[model samples]
Target: MGALVTLELPDDSPIHDLPWIITFGPLGDDDEWEPVVCGPYERPHALALAESVVADEDLMAVVEPLLPRLSADEIRGEIAASRIAAEDDAVQTEDADIYGDYEDLLDDEPGPETVQQHAEARPAPSPEELRAGMARIADKLGNLSG
Candidate 1:
């Protein structure tokens, strides 16, 4: 038996404003058979029509809402944005791979003195400090909720 399904869209979606269509295709592997697409009808009407069509033939039906077409400028802008993002990612990858001058390498490897200095510079917070920080965070969250 052939099955029928409708594509559900959210109530606020723009697609719900547009007309719906019913697409019928073979249930089995029938490459020679072409899909039959019918109409710009109301959602309810499309579902009814699809049900009737599916009953007769061994075909699956899908009721879908049409989407608005994108303008040429919109397409170009999207492509340009994608290209820029890709280029930026490539640049970042190349930068990460590069290890600078010998001085830069020497600076990255912290000597015993440097490591000791770093440890002294940033000591762990005291218990009182931790409690105060948590209280402050709780106050901020309470304010946001209220």
Candidate 2:
């Protein structure tokens, strides 16, 4: 069994030299259930231990850095910045004419007129001609069977 490892920083250089942790929990959408976290282990050791522990169990193990908890104000500021970035992207998309050149190319196309002309060049076979062709096929099939 393999462990799913997500690293926010380089393996050797954790923030303030903090330790890594192995978190095990349900692989379902159970929001109320809390995950069991074990560690303060070195990065490499945590990963190996996590893999061996979850090999026989039906749980998922995640190996990540154990960073200091964020304050409520910091979280709110991050959310505000994300919202501003999204709004700026929406405004830029609205102001820019992304399809202007594509619309011109569409207009330059010859449309279905050329296809209709090519199809019109070939006339449909007459009823008598079609009957003769069918008769020829039937005769060939009968000869093959004999």
Candidate 3:
């Protein structure tokens, strides 16, 4: 199975509309390298802009506004749960008050109801959901331009 890759990056401004070539890692002698022009590349221009953004700083600031809206969906898909442990911890801390409320409720009754309800109520979405959400967000973002 192929791994999924996501890069939420800034646009290639000041260099926008410029053509580029896409290539994979080292190719064998028998295998010819595939090079596609900017318009025909499988991925969108935003991704190329993003990749170029990582390699170049001047383009980063131009796409700042688009980053936040796409970050969550991409984070969910590309970042492993283990990799985001600290962020998860921070998120838990942000919801500490709710946790405290649950603690208070549990303190009143050391029973299974609280655990069961919480487990059943809380939902962890599948990867496909994340992909769809990200695609939707990307489409919305792509639409904003003229």
lDDT (10s digit) by residue, model 3, range 1-146: 11113435357653333322333222234434442222222245545554663453212211222222234555675567656887888788878755454555444645455433334444556667766986796687578765
Q: 2 or 3, which is superior by TM-score?
A: 2
Q: How do the candidates rank by lDDT, highest first?
A: 1, 2, 3
Which residue pairs does candidate 2 place in steric collision?
Answer: none
Give each model's whole-structure lDDT: 0.74, 0.68, 0.44
lDDT of 1 by residue, 24-46 (tens): 88888654477889876778789
Candidate with more favorable, higher lDDT: 2 or 3: 2
Off by over 4 Å in 3: 1-121
Q: For each candidate, what TM-score against the reference?
A: 0.45, 0.40, 0.22
Better of 1 and 3 by lDDT: 1
Scanning candidate 2 in windows of ten residues, the lowest lDDT window is 114-123
